[model samples]
Target: MNVTLEQARALDALARQGTFAAAAKALHKGHTAVLYALRTLEEQTELVLLDRRGYRTRLTPAGERVLEHCRKLLEAERELEAACAEIRAGWEPTLRIIFDGIFPAEPLLRVVKQLRAEGAGTRFHVSAEFLAGVEAAFTRDEADLMVSVLPPTLPDLRSYRLADLKAVLVAHRSHPLATQRGPLKDEELARHLLLTVRGSDPRLQLSTGALEGRSTVHLNDFAAKKAAILEGLGYGWLPEHLMKRELRRGELKALKLASGATHLFHPSLHHRAGVRLGRAASRVVQALTGVELPTPP
Candidate 1:
């Protein structure tokens, strides 16, 4: 109570982000201003908050205590504001969701629409990227919330399970091997050209030795892989959601590789581990899924 909330917040921002410049930008001030404020705060409290070494920043024992108090105070303040808003004017305020290309647009869009219908005045900014693009974006702290194929968890990152996507082999109906359906045997593929995503994950499923006699084409991402197939290059496995239009329009047809031979890829919602999620992310979590990822205690 000796220190103002602004001082506590500055300390929290630096501790959570691990960089002075980043914390400064987030607090809407210059790096020098943050430095000056923290210096003043520490002088007033007569305690060290940050253990700074060259460009690296870390919280000291005292700083850690300050951050804990800061988070509690901030959460209380936010809850108070939300209570007043809920009683006075109904709204979620803001939301930014970064998603993978595989999750499909319609379903996620529908979720956002449903939230609005519930009187949640949420503004949604949906960023759709290919698998790796979205993953990279999340890692870079560019997205508030993420929906992507599960990757190895990164430090200071938490995830929630969303749904599963089934991938299947696809081809133009006029292809020679189009008639051979119902859990395709690898033997049958030797006669048809093959298109697959270029990566260790995709390669693990598609072996070079297995495709020895087959004509193979590897592309950067799903969009490119789908494009290669559209040009009649080769048959490629695609996400169930991406091929909905083609499946319905007879432009592309899905072939079952094997009965119950499903690849159950998980789509998960992810957010920064320690940093608290903002209003938009919270609303999306509550509205779309009845789940909220707990922040570090």
Candidate 2:
């Protein structure tokens, strides 16, 4: 049966002080209200709680057992309440962050270090995945934050542009495409095998060299795509950050199209705005990027 604070306190006070009037005084109640609390507790438990001998009241054997249980429970609740109060007065226990595959990992590591320096005592449990995969995490309550390339459709998610990146087509310097026409002409590009992300489809054919009839290889795995290009398997396009070091060494070179344009990757930070993310999740967004992320209601 359920026991209220007043019932437990009234019983404890009466046992400790030995009188109904004094127990009611200890509970800051009228003698009748204290009597009512005790009565309700007794009814719920189906146990006789007090023995009244004229104006004197004492605990029965059953009341004594109930009193022991009540005292322990009440003391434990009080300790929990005190601990919760301390938590509210100080800081959160931990923070969960979700980062996309494209979000610069090093920058996030720096942010974590900075947070530690500020004495937040906040620990971040990060779940990182591709932007598409990150959306799944939000839906399943697996991630508190999501950083990804902005999806054209996200009806229930909120996002803010956090950073920009450049996407470029690159190939091993030894590739046949790299040896093609000096000006890197359209006709020459069409003659070589093309590699691209499967989802982008050939419609994202950024290069006229990537004409409709060209031989092509579509890949979804990033590591495989990179390994293929490095082994002189084919010409491929990738986000610049992923190939930054190789590009620096001239092992790979950017493909320049007739239009002289390079692709840009814009990273968006997303969370289930106005609803899903807890307070610490929101705070981390503000604290890290100085941007207020939105939420769903």
Candidate 3:
């Protein structure tokens, strides 16, 4: 009931690092200090926090629940500090960006490096989502800016064209479809398993680049989808940028559709309408908008 923030932080650190010594090292404090804080917290709360019987320290059931709350408290404290610092420096305290999985990673990384190089003080949090997942992140107020492919139209949202990505249907070389001659028919494509990225929306499951009525395997992320394709588990559309090495190495073969078609995915940057962007966010937007990625050959 009267626990201090330091005590709460020690509990969180101890839960994460699994031992007082490791937690102390992470917190840049003496081991005894970490122990003292956690013990003080336990005494104040009248709860047994650490189970010290095993080789590795662990949280008791009550400790686990208490630590969960501590984590939230710590997160809020961090945000508060960041906000104060940003206000003092005339910058936005934090910027949250969610990028679609299909978007090229190299350019994003470059932009981040450039931001750091400029000594920008804005705290950045970035995450990757696929398909409707990107839009969902935005709608949930989880991000301040989003880069997405075919983002759903929403009221009070503004969008700008960021870049286009080339996507091609592909499968592992060992897959039977890879041996088929000429453009593959829809029926032929449907017979094979389709690896699709799962959407984040709980109310409505969504998919892109998937043939209707096809046998499918849904994966959580692009990396998992690519891995499934590499394992010959299924064929699916992949960003050309991500599969270049695999294609060059003959590990994956592009599937020629009946129309001999490849898709150009237009990814756009989005932000809430009427929301003023912080200096760092604006710079990031400018850098990304100006970036010119090489067209897939």
Candidate 4:
């Protein structure tokens, strides 16, 4: 038996409104039309979908199951209509953004939340990568935009300086290096493990703040590296922003290095040169450049 979307819609309205007249009012249709649609749906499915015996109509057990499926169809139709409207309004259907994991995601996510509320209907696929992995993913996926510390030397690349990420060399308070008063020497640091995040793209060789001939452990992301460092596993560089609570609690201490304890990473927003950005991408760039960005929660 073939069931129509119109029939599904009628059943949905009837289930929601709880009465035929109420359902008709909600659908902007006559009471008779609503009744006919429900009747046809029941006949087509060979199921007693509605229990009309009640003072106010209610769906039978089978009707509830059918309603669940009908709701999905209605939701899909709504999404399709929304997508079409977005396309007509010159919003890109999808935007892929690859950013360095070291960069804070709150600002970008806050901007996205604002854009979504403003009816900028671009679907976003955001990925956080480490160092060279950001550029690698951006090039491999031909992503719409990227936020990276390693700006690729491509001919048609456009980049805008977003923010400087201050990275501090840190270790757990209980670690041997934490007790050292003076600037940590090369030999002192080399004696412990260096917790570092491995780039997503293994083929591209990259490292940050690593010493030669040091005992090392590669991790997947900064979160894992942070966990390892907090467990007194090793010492490595961490974003200063991420260390605020730990530093305040005396759980993690910044190392005073002979070379330097802190370094600045200039992560920038990059896109293809000469390519005009859609509304969503433009908003992202604007927000990243400190234009009316919401305060971090």
Worst 10 residues of 3 by lDDT: 199-208
Where in model 2 is the C-alpha error above 4 Å?
1-96, 116-123, 182-193, 196-198, 201-224, 276-280, 292-297
How well does each candidate superpose onto the true structure, as a TM-score? 0.53, 0.56, 0.65, 0.73
Tell how far residue 188 is off in model 1, in angstroms: 4.5
Of the pair 2 and 3, which is ahead by lDDT?
3
Tens digit per residue, CA lDDT, model 4, 66-164: 999989989999999989988777688898999999999898899889988987878899889888778889889989889988757666887888768
Which candidate tops lDDT? 4
| Candidate 3 TM-score to native | 0.65
Candidate 3, residue 176: CA error in Å?
0.9
Report, for all candidates in order, the number of backbone clashes: 2, 5, 0, 0
In candidate 1, how many Å is residue 292 off? 5.1
Report the number of backbone clashes for model 1: 2
Ranked candidates (TM-score, high to low): 4, 3, 2, 1
Candidate 1 — worst ten consecutive residues by lDDT sum?
200-209
lDDT (Cα atoms) of all candidates against the true structure: 0.70, 0.70, 0.79, 0.83
In model 2, state the lDDT of residue 41: 91
Clashing pairs in 2: 273-294, 273-295, 273-296, 274-295, 274-296
lDDT of 2 by residue, 64-86 (tens): 99999989988988977765653
Return the TM-score for candidate 2, rounded to 2 decimals: 0.56
Off by over 4 Å in 4: 1-76, 199-213, 290-297
